[model samples]
Target: MSPTLSPSPFGTAKTLVLKVGSAVLTNADGDLDKGMLRTIADWTSERMAAGCNVILVTSGAVAAGRSALGVRDRNLTISQKQALAAVGQSRLMQIYAELFATHGFHVGQMLLTAGDMEDRRRYVNARYTLEELLRRRCIPIINENDTVTVDELKFGDNDGLAARVAVKMQADALVLLSDVDGVFSANPKTTPDARLIEVIEKVTPALIEQLCPTSQTGSLVGSGGMLSKLRAARLATSAGTHVAIANGKRPGILSNLVAGKFVGTYFPPAPTHRSQRTQWILHGRVSGTRQVVVDDGARDALLHRHKSLLPAGILRVVGTFKAGDLVDIVDSAGRLLGRGIVNYSSAEMDLIRGHRSADIAKILGAKPYDEAIHRDNLALFEEVTSAR
Candidate 1:
């Protein structure tokens, strides 16, 4: 029986980012699935003809390269995986180039690491490059730079990478093509009664608990699972980009999905905020240098008054860090207010803590900026919590 296709909210998106996992692009025997790749390319070309911009974020190089190298080891070392990625990235892009070209569409490959997106200058450069590609009528096929990525610089999975790309390009929607049809109330394979959730308005903790019990393990060929997809959904939605998680194995799935036909789980966008810096501050995985606690008055001034974080409001600085590092801003009760880039080093902040902004010169002997965290660089937690 054909699964029922309902209206999708993605019908209106002008620019879309579509991500396909390793499992979707690989066969059970672990070779690249040429048929599936062709289908996706065809659909993407058609979408482009209809005046919609499409960026394809894909994962399969490691799986494909490993197969070509005749390595059957399930657990390969980081170096081995990197070797596979180095080898397979080219082969994968070759296939994409050939297939997309067959349909009269050009493809541009972009390899990136999480660090590239975290750095402000690199982030801007990437965004401009993608925009220019789209303007030139070329589809940008992106993948993680797995060959050189280490733990600190890794996005861990393409799910998070796709979300960041969507936000960076100001895409209207993000489509995640995976092995599953959608997010089920329970594991569909183990539980016959598991219900497929059609639309998710919010990724609440309760919903996560109900759908994801233990962390979901990906298919034999992919690293991303349900948990990573959910995290991606949260990030994309928070940035006002709608997201859809659907079965990639289905024929013409991308076309059907954007045609207002229900395919997989859909996550609606949050309130639109055009501030890209704010989105970066909210979702960028730059490890914070320290925790800065503020009193209720400071919290109100930051949130309601839309003011910069002044030294007067800082209660304390918790750790050692240099200037220009990310820091967490919390309230007296330990509630997370948001995150921002601090202008002063932890040592300097310690000296200026609780002092008025005017006294910064007297204390640190030099002040780069009056605000501890400028309003432009600050982002508030999107979740609503009662004032303590």
Candidate 2:
């Protein structure tokens, strides 16, 4: 039987990150929706005055630029979209500055990409920058660097960005503000009787496949869909951050959320809590297609004994990856054990698997310490096989 979902008692989340979608940021003419922006700014200011930290992950730079250029090219190439974002980003920030200024608030613009979140050094630097902004009572407004983010331009959205940021910052709650109120049992447009799922206990592979059958496109200006939001929710919640998918169009939605009013579908954070570094390892991007499958003994050591992965327990190495890169560690059955920075490359791993630590120098003619993945660099996931 499926587990019943219930909302956790999250009393006035102190640190909040809000992801406002392109639909809410732009109007019908593919332009920036200043009125809506002002409304959001107003409530957000009120929340700030009440001593709540709010960081905005916004969308609509592309649409803003296209509207300014009067370019109605629906079939825009990746280069074209990048050009548009380059033009619109400044204009978008300018407007955000003006609106936020009226409430005696300052907004800091941060243009990020997927690559920034993958490299540990870059990720740490970005977090420090964000922390400094918040320390000065400045609202950090973040968006994808679409002008140069080739991968993101293909299909990524701020929804994914927001999730990554929330986990990195260890935010108390992440509110995804979009056109729709929340995730539904089915597509509301086609399935008239489809009910809104008010609470999601856990997001599993089966649940995602059941609801998001065909990807639903966003507004004329945006590209993200409900599927993206669900994925975002899953990522954030796994890192022990509460998530809510609420309607941006709903009047006083921000105020309602601050007041603890029921506004959207809620996803309670999972029980396990992790340190900041652990959060990064769990969510950090894998460098290559490489996966190191460990034997049963290795899996036991990682999951229960809290030991670093050893070359002796590795059954086989798959794909190619260099040392110091992030890679997935899996069991022989293809179940993910964890992910971490590898101390050995796939080429080296091939020769070292099932070998004794003392034999490393004999085989490779050198040694670079022991342990394929050190415990300090590894992070176990919330979901893992039960201990035998």
Candidate 3:
């Protein structure tokens, strides 16, 4: 039997991340839709009046950039696109500032690159800034620093960016406003009989593979489609944030979504609490400099007994990392097993590999502890598997 769908605890959410997609905020001509902006601003202001802290992640800089530069060509190079973003970001923010001010609300702009979250110190600092803004009752309007990000570091879309923001802020809910009503069984344009999936309790690998196949041409300014939204929903929901994908073109959509109107597809939060540190590791926000591949014995020991990883079980070590740097754990077949902070460096582990705990000091000429990754610091992928 399918699990019953339930509304997230209303008015209990202290912090919310509202993600407005490019298609929702811009017209086919790639111009900002003032009417749509006003509706969103008004609804958000109402929530703020009710004492709910809101952070907005918006897309449209590229669109704004295109309009500002008077570029009608769709095949602009990355450099040209970046140039447009530089010009349009400020213009987009100006519109937001003016619209929000009319509702008597203060807003702050925060531009981030993927690097910001990849570095542990920067991650903490970003969280601190957002918290400070919320404490001061100011809305933080966040967007990816497209002008600075290289292709590899780019979040690819605001939906993924929003998920990262939600994880950073420990937000209770993430509302993704897009052009479509919600996620459907198939691409709505192609499959006229496609049915909307009203609620999702869990996103399985199979379900992830079943995401909409057709890509909706984004507003001249944005770069995401419904598939990106679903991917974002999966990421956010896995991090323990309730996510809703709704139509941004609909009137008062944000308010209606939060008011239990069931306006769009809702991805329910994971039933367990994922420790913040674990979430960061699992999400790959912080890149691990090293990796260790374990055998079946080590995998079983870690997954079933919650045992510390010993040198004897490690088959290979990849990359150089410090003692405290997060590292990936993989199996013999090369699939990622999990991640944990290593107690020894790759150089140190190489000498100690396949050795017993008693031989640690004898082999390395020194020792901190017998285990490579203490049981306490390790989180297994089996936990997620069992949750399913």
Using lDDT as the measure, what is the rank order of every candidate, best first? Answer: 2, 1, 3
Q: Which window of ten consecutive residues has the lowest lDDT sum in model 2?
A: 1-10
Ranking by TM-score: 2, 1, 3
In candidate 3, stretches whose alpha carbon ends up further than 4 angstroms from where it belongs are 1-12, 152-155, 212-221, 286-290, 319-323, 344-352, 356-369, 382-388
Name the candidate that leads on TM-score.
2
| Stronger candidate by lDDT (1 vs 3) | 1
Residue range 1-388, candidate 3, lDDT tens digits? 1122334432457788999987898887877888888888888888888898899998878788878878889777777778888998999999989998988888999998766765667878999999999888888999888788656223256787788889888889898888878888877767899888888887765576667545443333467777677777877787789888888887766656666675688887887767776676665443534689898899888777778999999998998887877788888888777888789988898888888889999998888898999877777663444742
**What C-alpha root-mean-square deviation, in Å, does candidate 1 show against the real structure?**
2.9
Predicted structure 1, TM vs. truth:
0.89
Candidate 1 regions exceeding 4 Å error are 1-12, 152-155, 271-274, 288-290, 295-297, 315-321, 385-388
The lDDT per prediction is 0.83, 0.83, 0.78
- For 84-177, candidate 1 gives per-residue lDDT tens digits of 9989999999999999988788899999987787778888999999999999999999998989876512325789999999999888989999
- For residues 168-247, write the lDDT of model 2, one tens digit per residue: 88889998998887988988878899988888989865688788875665555678888889889988898889888988
lDDT of 3 at 44: 81
> Native-vs-model 2 lDDT?
0.83
Where does the lowest 10-residue lDDT sum fall in candidate 1?
1-10
lDDT at 116, model 1: 84
